[model samples]
Target: MQASRTLSRSGVAVATARPVLQFLAIMLIALVAGSTFGIWRGYDPGGYSALTFLETLQGAVGGLNVTLPLMGAGALVMTGILAVMARRDRPVAVAYAFAFVLMAVAAVITRFANQPINADVVTWTPDSMPANWTAIRDVWWHWHVVRTMLSMLGLAVLVLAIMADRNRSSAPSA
Candidate 1:
């Protein structure tokens, strides 16, 4: 009876953790994608050539088109789950909620600030490159730094929330 009860509790714990795991996985993907972009920005070997840099930026943005939506959706769903969990664990829920909001803010920054820069970059040709192309590229890099930090922070908070949940589940019941 004791073993069976323990197994049942374990199952419940696993079920409860599923969404958190999903959220973490999504955040990890976003972090990796953002980190790749940041590394490219830092190591841009073709910095002197506008055509090469613009081509690279175009490819990077194309990849982001897929990852960004997944990250946004993951954050939204995680926020909803955390909101429901708030009924029982308000503190952890609140922390996770705020983290997810930060993640959303990151996405907003990418869309509003970075996409416009990407759009401008995509339209540039070697012959028609603007005098301020480097300035615009610098702006894009700045916003990418902001979003990357935000996503990483969100991931850290979600990990903390997972730890809290595990501790709560394992505590001795009165």
Candidate 2:
């Protein structure tokens, strides 16, 4: 009985530590990439112009190209690891793990969907834009915005789970 209890406690320790470590690793990469891209975008020579819609699109997409890939890779890799460590019976951890999966999906959608729009924008002038370009941009950009918001919410949930686990572990023994 005592041996079983010890093993269980150790298992919890491993589970608790895994997400925090993953979060830190992923966040470090994200912060560095995000900051670097932000600087690049800020210093871009093509200041916004009504005639330069495509130029602005190129810059926006370029920034996302770097960050989204990193975020996607991190999400997919960490989620795979987290899936193994997660205890299905624990609701909070399960939810957090699911959030990682959502992030991965969002990253992929942004890559394939938004990136193509950006590619077209780079070569396109307003007059040359496809008949439905405005509609396409409106719908796709809306989805991208939602995904960004969802990612933030997901991160918050994951952090909450980590903090809850930490608190439970640090509580005085019964």
Candidate 3:
């Protein structure tokens, strides 16, 4: 590789993008994974909320809340880009595509599953809680765990893909 793609024929910048896109995807997924980790550890469904479940949910939506949409969007966009970038390299491409699918599934789980529960939960007060509060909470918790696992799994696959890609890049040509 030449010192720069500035010369155009150097073709150096083209190679740099695979690793950069992989890194961005990794960082974004890692952020989402950490959010899931924090939720499970700090305010899981098992935790009692004297105030109310809605209050608990609302309270947790302060600092991290603003960044969540951005993180999710950034993660998906970056992962998709990485998947497309790796398209010519079959094994590496497949890995990135799998990672993107995993992340997308997590997004779908949030949009269709968790968001509905969240909407209902927002209408609740301590005294207004339905007789089946725990049941609703249980459903929410189950999906949360599933999506969290998928997000982390995506992160792992992304990291490995980047590693494999770099190895291929560095290998001496036959």
Per lDDT, the best of the predicted structures is: 3
Better of 2 and 3 by TM-score: 3
Per-residue CA lDDT of model 1 for 26-142, tens digit only, reads 565456445645655575533557777777787777776557756666665765566466547787677767767877777788779888888887777778889988888788778
TM-score result, candidate 3? 0.84
How many backbone clashes can be found in candidate 1? 0
**Rank order by lDDT, top first?**
3, 1, 2
Q: What's each prediction's TM-score?
A: 0.75, 0.65, 0.84
Those runs of model 2 whose alpha carbons end farther than 4 Å from true positions after fitting are 1-22, 25-50, 125-127
Residue-wise lDDT of candidate 2 within 15-130, one digit each (tens)?
Answer: 67786776763574355334434534463333434355555666666666676666556655665565555565376467657667666656666677766766777777766777
Model 2 scores what on Cα lDDT? Answer: 0.60
- Candidate 1 residue 54 C-alpha distance from true site, Å: 0.7
| Model 2: how far residue 93 lies from native, Å | 2.7
Tell me the whole-model lDDT of each prediction, alpha carbons only: 0.69, 0.60, 0.78
Which ranges of candidate 3 are over 4 A from the true structure?
Answer: 1-10, 47-52, 61-66
Candidate 1 lands at a TM-score of 0.75
By lDDT, the better pick of 2 and 3 is 3
Candidate 1: the clashing residue pairs are none
